[model samples]
Target: MKKLENLQKQLGYEFKNIKILNEALTHKSTKMPYNNERLEFLGDAVMDLIVGEYLFKKFNKIAEGDMSKLRAALVNEKSFAMMAKELKIGEYINLSLAEENNGGREKISLLSDAYEAIMGAVYLEAGLEKVREIAINLLEICYPKIDLTNLVKDYKTALQEITQADFGVTPVYELTGSSGPDHKKEFEIALLLNGKEISRATGGSKKEAQQTAAKIALEKLKK
Candidate 1:
């Protein structure tokens, strides 16, 4: 509770219903009665609205597609997790021992969901205007960190360019394997150039895997 209070001060928003705040920080894996799933759902909608409105007003000259892309870049799991880390929100999150042992505190999905839940809690606490204020404030903090140039590149194109420029060979991607339940399966992908492995990455889907592979290749080459 002390941690949450500190977080509220840091975030510039106080909850009218403290229970909601508590619930927002509770992970579903704990099987807690007041889990954050519902809040996460509502927060997802609120986030889309706030981000859409911000991008629409801020980038008036940008095309709808680009605006949408920017919004997506801002609201994804990776960005949300990064934001959560910045806020030190992970310290306040409540998770079961099993989850905590498995690195739930640092997990992107949990962090992102917690971020959404906080948004939902804010919306419920003070309405859209207050939520908008917090959302915009956070957006300001996040905007500079978003690399739009890198965000705009497609995986295949980016990988090709990197491999071609770096090693003078076209990059090839192979579906190494996939596993898990249908709803939450993971895919492993490997990127190769000139018959040598450049990098490998895993993701929830094949396309994501390719993008992650490309991102890994980018990091390797950038080093």
Candidate 2:
């Protein structure tokens, strides 16, 4: 077995009970005496509480709905996977021969679960405050890279909310035209509100074009 001392070094917290750390890295596919599922469950809840508290305190004036969205963006599987990759958690993960042969080490779901399991183990061996410090340090590294504007839901939804509130009607998107080859095509889209064309934009796909149009419309509406 590879040494976990490097993982502990990366985490900046050494486990007094190293067995717990091993269990955290063990997947169900390994058919070990103990696996990470229980630890993952605990870690999930711990993460939620920690992230929610952080966001609540940090974004004091932000609306609850917006805060919820930010929390979701932070605690999501992709975010966890990114953190796991940064920590090289995959290197320490224990998988069966079949799973290893099938490239289980690079699987995002497994990495994310293992990350949470490690957190749970950290909490168990240390305490909530210790785990919280580690989690916050990881999140600090992650938070700045995230673009909150892009993380907001599709532009159409934002446009709909603005139109509904201001005009008591939903905005509509129309495919204006397309150009180029099918594989590399570009689409043009227009946004209409209450039967009046508000804005138009182009993108690499119909969805992207529509979003661009909606974003343009939103900019116009906000002016």
Candidate 3:
């Protein structure tokens, strides 16, 4: 209860209905009668609507396909997980002993789902504008450069172009390691340039890990 109150302070939005807030932080792993599943469902819809509206109004001239791509890039597990990490949502979630032992606190999907439930709880209590204010602020802070070229840029392609121009060969991404359960595996990628490890990164998927490693390589190579 004290931690929940502190979470409110951290969120900067006090809840009139703390029950919803508690529900939002609850996971099904806890075997509770009322978990965050329903809240997560509501939050998922809320996130899409807010982001769709934001993109629509912000990028009036952009085509529908591009907007869809942008939304896809933003409204996903990886993105929300990162934001939830920032808010320390993982630390506050109610998980069972077995789930906790399995490192559910650090699980991206759990964090993502909890964050959605948080949004859902906020929206239910305070409406769209209030939740939008909170979500957009977090989005901008979490993703400082939120635009078409920035969000949709193919870092892997860009890295290849640079590598080819300089080394006359493209960089290679190799899976160095993987961890977590099968359903929530995190892939580790090593970006190799001319057979030397240039950078390494991890992500929810291989492609994501490769892209992230490529992005890191691009930055260092540029410098």
Candidate 4:
């Protein structure tokens, strides 16, 4: 239809087999025999490969672990959903009446899956090169808006790396105390670097408090 044609124009790849494109847009909620699930699965792998290769080449000097984190940040559901939203992909999805009423079009999971399915359809119709081109173009548009450095920084992991690299010792997180009622208890945690307390933070849970403390430690160490 007109909508499909417009989407094809937007994607810059006209499908030889429109059925595949239609399948990509069709949600499982429709209960249709042909849906996007299989395409989504294929696309997920394809995306991982493409993104991994991209980061590997672009950040050639970076370590494998750093590249992995960058790839994860780029290919996550939230990032895919943002790309889909930018493309206005939700308007073209074929959802069941119930799903439509429930605002399925705006659902991040649905949008991300559909975007992946569309990528799969593109790959099947065109080729890996063509799909890679499309992905790179989209990523180029998205990259400037993303904080690549922060995206790869897991507080605890960052703290550990810093401590080990600088002091030749690992960072440790200790639960210092807890307050409030049992159900709503808030935990206080401290980060220790080489047996010396570096920072402390409070959060609703021990893990959160530890992360906060780690973040604080990282900040202070960097400063």
Candidate 5:
């Protein structure tokens, strides 16, 4: 009860219909009659438009393709999960005991979905304008210097360019290992240059691991 109040405070927007907020926080694993999936779908669409319009207005002279990439950069599981963490959404989630034991609260997909559902609930209850304000507030906070050049940061490509120039070889990614439940599997990947290991990282998926490893490798190259 009190925790939900704190969640609303964290969001900086109080919900007129608290039940809808609960529905948004309820996971399918709870076997509730009403879960957050539908709200997640709606929120996903809403966020797409919000981000699309933001990019459209922010970069008036940018091409359609570039705008799409920018939107893609922001509207992703990773980005949403980061925002979920910012709002501490995981703490308010209603998960099954099994899921809780499986670290559902920390799962990227779960957090991202909850974030979307919350936004969706907001949109449904208040309207697009209110939800847009909340979304923009979070985006600006999460990415304080949000801009075109830094949005779609392709660390893998940057590392490749650097390695190619110096070692005349591209960085290779090797899947080292994976574990955890199928719904929330963790993948470990090693970044290699000239058949030698440079950096290793673990993430929610292979692509995530690859990107994390690439980012780590890039940092190492920088120093």
Candidate 6:
């Protein structure tokens, strides 16, 4: 109860219907009577609209495709997970003991869904204006630089950029290894820049590992 009160204070918006807030943080894996899936859907739509409007006004010359990609990057699951971590939201979540033990609190998908559910709940408790303020603040805090140039650029994009700009040859990625339990396997990926080993990284998924490798390569090239 005290923890929930502290969380509410940190969010700066007291829920008129606390149940909505509770529902938003509930994960279906816990077999809870209520989950935040519906709220997550609604919040996703709301998030897109807010981000779209912000980009539309700020980057007037930016194309629709570019704006959409940037918005997606800013509001992605990983981004939400970061925000949840910052807020220590996992500690406040109501979860079964087993789920908690399995690191449910730190799960990216679950945290992202909870973030969206909170948005939906806020919109319902207050209004669009309140939710908009919250969304803008959250985004601004998460990305102080707001560099749209690389916001949505993934490992594939980075590799392509490096290949075109430097070697004039495309990079290739190879799966080095995969380890860990089935539910929590870690992938090892290596990216070769024009046939030269550039960087390698490990992640929970192949795409993620590739992205990490590309990111490291980008940093190395920059340095």
Local accuracy of candidate 3 as per-residue lDDT tens digits, 1-223: 7778778877879999788999999999989999999999999999999999999999999999989989999999999999898889988999999999999999999999999999999999999999999999999888888887678858999889888988899888899999999999999999988899999999999988998898899899889
Model 5 residue 159 CA deviation (Å) reads: 6.7
Q: Scored by CA lDDT, what does every candidate get?
A: 0.85, 0.88, 0.93, 0.88, 0.92, 0.83
Taking all chains together, each candidate's TM-score versus the true structure is 0.69, 0.71, 0.71, 0.71, 0.71, 0.69
The ten-residue window of minimal lDDT in model 6 covers 146-155
- In angstroms, the error of model 4 at 91 is 0.3
Kindly list the per-residue Cα lDDT of model 2 for residues 149-168, writing each as its tens digit: 55665779888987898889
Write candidate 1's Cα lDDT for 1-223 as tens digits: 7667899988788776788999999998889777999999999999999888987887678788888788888888887787777778899899999999999999999999999899899898788998898877777777665444555647678778867887788888899999999999999999887778898999999988988898788888888
Model 4, residue 158: displacement in angstroms?
9.5
* Model 5 residue 52 distance off true place after TM-score fit, in angstroms: 0.6
The deviation in Å at residue 178 for candidate 3 is 46
**Root-mean-square deviation (CA) per prediction:** 13.7, 10.5, 13.9, 12.3, 14.1, 13.8
Of 3 and 6, which scores higher on TM-score? 3
Q: Model 1: which ten-residue window has the lowest total lDDT?
A: 144-153
Better of 1 and 4 by TM-score: 4
Residue 183 alpha-carbon offset, candidate 4, angstroms: 53
Judged by whole-model lDDT over C-alpha atoms, candidate 1 comes out at: 0.85
lDDT tens per residue, model 5, 95-176: 9999999999999999999999999999999999999999999998888876655777568888899999998999999999
